[model samples]
Target: MEMTKKIAIIGAGPGGLAAGMLLSQLGYEVNIYEKNDRIGGRTALHKMGKYSFDIGPSALTMTHVLTSLFMDCKRDILDYVSLLPINPIHTLYFQEVTFPLYSDYAATKAVIKTYFPGEEEGFDRFMKENTKKMLYISPLNQFNYSSLFDFFRPTTLRAIPSLTLGRSLMDDLARYFNSKYLRLAFSLQMRYLGMSPWDIPAAYSIVPFSEFYYGTFHPIGGQNKIVEAMQQVVTENKGKFFFNSEVTDFELEGNEIKGARLASGQVIEADYYFTNLDFMYSLGNKPNNHLEKKEYSSSAFMLYLGLSIVLPLSHQSIVFPDNYREFSDNTIHKKILSKDLAIHITNPSATDNTMAPINHSSIRIMVSVPNNTSAIDWDKETKEFRQLILDTVKERLDFPDLDDYIEEEYIITPKDWEEKYHVKYGAVFGLQHLTRQHGFLHPSKKLPKYKNLFVIGAGALSGSSLPFIIENAQITTRKFLQKENPSNQ
Candidate 1:
């Protein structure tokens, strides 16, 4: 038998835990170092009094990705964590009407045609086209995207129609809808990537396709339970986890990584290192050079409210601005603060019993904003931004007495996320999905100067979604395992 290779993964985010769990099962000695006391980096949970909320990634789309990962480990996923389906996936509140999008193909089309009318054909065409686009591009998402040239491989070019190069997600969706409201519905997936549809690559239309195809989900306890389940898997496989251990820097011998040095002055050696941190944070003092030159994604202003009273609301709702284009341009491109803005509301307690007190609810409000790349003074501005969000939500969403019902409230500005999570430029989703930043144009997953180091997670390969993060971990683990084999070596 070959000797086991010791591995050290920085950050216990979903990516790190997934890799640690899988690789540990393969008989590697895996150790995960997490800066925070809890696991699940960004998707971790928060508790205030009797109310509980998922700090990030409240919605879980493409849950099959997780199902497959757990099953591949020879464990039934449902046994570890329970996932509840999010039907009528999201309710969209436009100026004139409220639209509910369902997961069923027939139901979604019917809703679109009923509201927009004379638009069934385009809706079908979009489903057909983006369905094909999703199938064609999905396998590529798992490819060890080392460089741009690898993206031009013959397998990808055949899926050319799905590329729709040089066009934006908004432009491509325009072909599918005459209704600005309907177009907004389909193109709104761009916001999840922290980019505007007007600038994000048309290839990203896969966001909506994935949502409709696989449907949206929420775990029983909270979305953070997904991370908790992954951590359980790691422990079952004998993987070790070190919490409250912040990695100060890498210990390198020549070009290869020897191990990582912790803030506690402990040095643990490993044969290989995986960074679950965002790409920029992983680089530390290393010259970012081309890495910094890439466009970073936008940030978010968030409010986590623990309500004394449960409101009759869906698991998720989107309130769109009367003019979405102007809103997108202001938040994404111009980086201007919009007093009147689009916001996402998530009420997890509406469905789950474990998230809050009896007859109470937990709500999260998120509004996209320019990342730290701008000159905005978040410390001073966030104080006012909180009031703007509270006022807007109460007015537009008809929660006039929200302030009185609030039992506990937690606000996170972009600066708060940056200072807390070590996110580069406070870009939660990492790189922008522009022509250069999307698809094969995504920056290299491996550091150009480091041979044994790998990057995985939102800021690295597989974009920002939770499923994609798990996929990135799987791909990175397999590649490393393959290289470990004598034949590949």
Candidate 2:
């Protein structure tokens, strides 16, 4: 009789949870070990009194990814979670004007004509060109490429033009928009990766394009609903979750992971090991201080505020600094916090009443800051920086008595990410998506020497965002099936 395969997953983040669902459905015995008592690492939920906030990922785009995952499992996603579409995806507040990005092509064009007349033509061209770019690149994003030879595949070869070699995101936007503010509006999506528009490659222009093409969504309760839904699927398939059971390190043989060692000194052996821990954190030791050489993405300082009054704001909003480029350079390159801040505020109460009590609001604020590599002392800086963000919001949004309404509050700085969450360098976005880190060049899902070990998370090939990470997990699962059941092929 053939023995059933057992897979051990470390960390119950989105990636691990998704992997558990996929693998369990494939008839594998799956066990997930998480350090925290709750699931959903960074994607976890936080509740204070009657208000709640999604700890990360304020909004959800790319609904099709979740739809496909559920379809593959022979289940309907709606049965587990409710998805509400967000119109006017997000509102952008400039110094002199407010602009809302809509999924409707005609509506977006009308807004462009109203705000900056001549730019309406540019919007049409931008959509047309970027649609082609997304078509060219989408196919290859689903592959699990571990080496440069993988790029030699016909699919990757066909994507070269869409890569837009040697062009930055700012340069690509400039090709269409003559207005600097308009360019800034489109490139605001760069914050999702913790990158500067002048630094990330033009191929990423597909990001903003995708937002307008496929409108964003909000899960009725919070972004964490996706996690809870996936967990339900995993549990229904007989997957087990071990909370507060941390996998401290892996016991290794010549070229395989023998077993995972937990913090309690327990050794759990399995047929395969999948870790969703932060990439660098999984390495156990940096080995010659190699970590000092790699470039990491910037970190975020987040504030979760539960207010006593309803906030008169859209579901999502971005308030740009007076000078975006300077602020980007300071926060991402110079490794310093800029007083001129670009803040993203999400008031989920606008669309989902479940987020807060009646007549109350739950607000989440995120500001980019230097990662843990910077010497800035978050202990000394968090108080003043928090006040600065609140003050800026009060002044810019004309909410004079904003402070008086804060009934409950929580903050996460780069320091808190490292000490509490164990994220390497407190880089919430993982590695920087530089030109050198694209496609085959990014960290491979499987290490060359580790025959039975794999990685799936923000640091892997698909990079950041909940959808990409979950998709990458699916790819990893398929690859695992092919390798272990070659005869079944």
Candidate 3:
């Protein structure tokens, strides 16, 4: 009788769940240990009264990547979850003016013409170049990162001219559009990765290309349904999941990770270990020896509100300040909240009734803030900052008597995220996606100290984003399987 290999996964995020499903399908006995009672790390949904808030990520793009994983594992994602396309993908509110960006290229072009008529030719050129860039960059995102120099190889070097790392996103947008409104609308997507357009590489504009091309979507029930579906897939594949089990430390023997010790003192061993938690957390007491510590991207302060009456806003709205640069720069050193900050509001109730009551609505207000874990006092700062955010949202959106309609409200500060998810400095995405730290420069999935240890999540290859995280899981699992069973291949 032959024994099957045993695998243990840390964290129940999308990356961990996807890797468990894949390895289980390959006849490996897999177990996932999650500190929280529920799966889906950042993708988890919180229910307050009748409102269901998507705790972290709001938009769902790159469905193909997810569906492909299901298909490869001989399962149908549609069977477990339903996804609906969101038209006009998102409504951009720039400098008090609003513009709708559609999934249809012709319609989007028409809207662009209306906003920046004189720049039509340049807009056309920009779209053509973006399409070309996406073709080259998207594949690189699906591959594993062994080293920074790998991207400079002959094959990757040929695509260097298309990467546009030489210029910033703002610099590239300025080359095409004369209207600051259009520039802000396009450049603001960089904020999704917690980067200012002036510092983010122009290649990141490929983000919009993928969204507009594939069309933005939301799961029919809520973002949480995606997690439920992944959970189902993992279970059906005979994988075990242990919730509320926190990992305290790794039990390493020689060059191999023997098992993980839970805070409760239980030990589970495996042949391979994949950690989906932030790479920094995996370092434990050895923070200095870990990847050179760099400042993480800005953490967000979110307010979820349940209203008695539905607001006339669309699914998504971005209210930018008069000076985008001021808001961007303030995040650098300031621990205090700003009145003229950028606000992103989303009404998931517009698409999913399950999120709110029949006649009511659910809204999430978000503002990026500095992770001031050291200087600012959270107890004093959270209260003052919450009031400031509420006042700013009302002033920008013209919603009167907001406190009156609020049936239920909850706020999540950076401090809350750090306490809940164990992310270092409460950084939403693992590392900041800057020019020098991106691509092969990001942490390698293969650890230097341990032979059987690997990483799969936002902190690993492909940067962040839901689709890319799942891709990292699939790619990492494939490499491990190949390494273990060369004869099978």
Candidate 4:
């Protein structure tokens, strides 16, 4: 008779939750430990009176990732979570002009012809080329790289030229879009990776293309609902979730992790451990002393507002600064906080009535900023930044008295992300996905010296996108399963 393997998972983030469900269904005794009082670390919901706001990932693209997970369990995604379509994906507002991008190819082309005239041909070529690039790159993301040379395989070798190896995301966009603002519009999707278009590799050009191809979505309740659905799946599969249970350190035997020490002075032992924490934060007295030398993604200064009155805005909108390139370089490279800022706002009340009370709005605003490595002091700058954000919103978004209807408000700074959430340096998206960081080069390496130890999350393969994180969890799970049963390998 075969004995069940005991699996210990740290952190209750999306990846952790998904891994729990997947492993539990396969007959493993899974236990997920979360530091917070609830599930969904960054994807958690914050309630302010009658308003419900998502702490992270307001929009959902690549629905098939979630669908595939549910289908694997012989269940339907819709039965677990209701996903609502977001038409005209998002409204992009520039200093001088504004336009909405549609998922419909013809409709989007029409908008391009109207706003960015003479660039329709560029849009066509971009879609055609990126579709091919996605076909090549998507499969690579699904692989579990055991070594750096795995990237040199035929599949990766064939993708070398299309990978935009030496070029930046902005460079790739410039090849298609003539207008700088249109390019900025396309490149803003890089923010999801917590990277600047000028720095992240051109292969990420697939971001905007995926948004246009697969479209975007929102859960009926909030982004948190997806995690709630996953939680239910895990629970039904006999997985146990321990809330407010924090893992302080791991007891190591040679290279294998023996047990996880919790904050309450209790140690939990398991045959296999899957740490879902940020990779940088999980390291202990390793070669890297302070982790100061490592490259991290940009952090965010977020504002969650519950307003008594709703704003006449789309479900999702972004306000780009006057000079996007300079703004990007200053914030991401020089670590300078400029007056010209790019603000991403999500008003979920417009699409889902459950987000707020009748006629009210639950708005989440995210501003990309340098991680904690910068000398910027959030304790002193938060109030000023809040004012700047509100002022900019009122002016650019055409809301003269946007502050009048605020019934409640919350602000999360980079400092808060570090102290409260334990994200290393408050880099919410974990490590930056630079060109060299792809495949086995990523810090979220699958094969660690400790054979029983594994990692899954934004800190893992690819980057911080929700779909990639889920796919990474799936791939990591597959690798682990195959190792346990050599026949599967």
- The clash numbers for all candidates, in the given order, read 0, 0, 0, 0
User: What lDDT tens digits, residue by residue, belong to model 4 across residues 182-240?
Assistant: 88888875469788888888988888999999989999999899999999999999999
lDDT of each: 0.82, 0.86, 0.78, 0.85
lDDT at 42 for candidate 4? Answer: 90
- Residues 253-364 of candidate 2 have per-residue lDDT tens digits of 8888898888899999999988874632555444524444667888999999999898889999899999998999998889998998999999999999999999999999
The candidate that achieves the highest lDDT relative to the unseen native structure: 2
User: Which scores higher on lDDT, 2 or 4?
Assistant: 2
Candidate with more favorable, higher TM-score: 3 or 4: 4
Where does candidate 2 have its weakest 10-residue lDDT segment? 279-288
lDDT of 1: 0.82
Clashing pairs in 3: none
Model 1: per-residue lDDT, tens digit, 62-108? 88899989987888889988888887788999878998998898999
Q: Which 10 consecutive residues of model 1 have the lowest summed lDDT? A: 276-285
Please report how far candidate 3 places residue 113 from its true position, in Å: 1.9
Best-to-worst ranking by TM-score: 2, 4, 1, 3
RMSD of each: 1.9, 1.5, 2.0, 1.6
Q: Which stretches of candidate 4 lie over 4 Å from their true place?
A: 277-284, 446-448
Per-residue lDDT for 163-214 in model 3, tens only? 8868988999888888888787777653478766777788888787777778
Candidate 2 regions with alpha-carbon error over 4 angstroms: 277-288, 444-448
Ranking by lDDT: 2, 4, 1, 3
Model 2 residue 342 lDDT score: 94
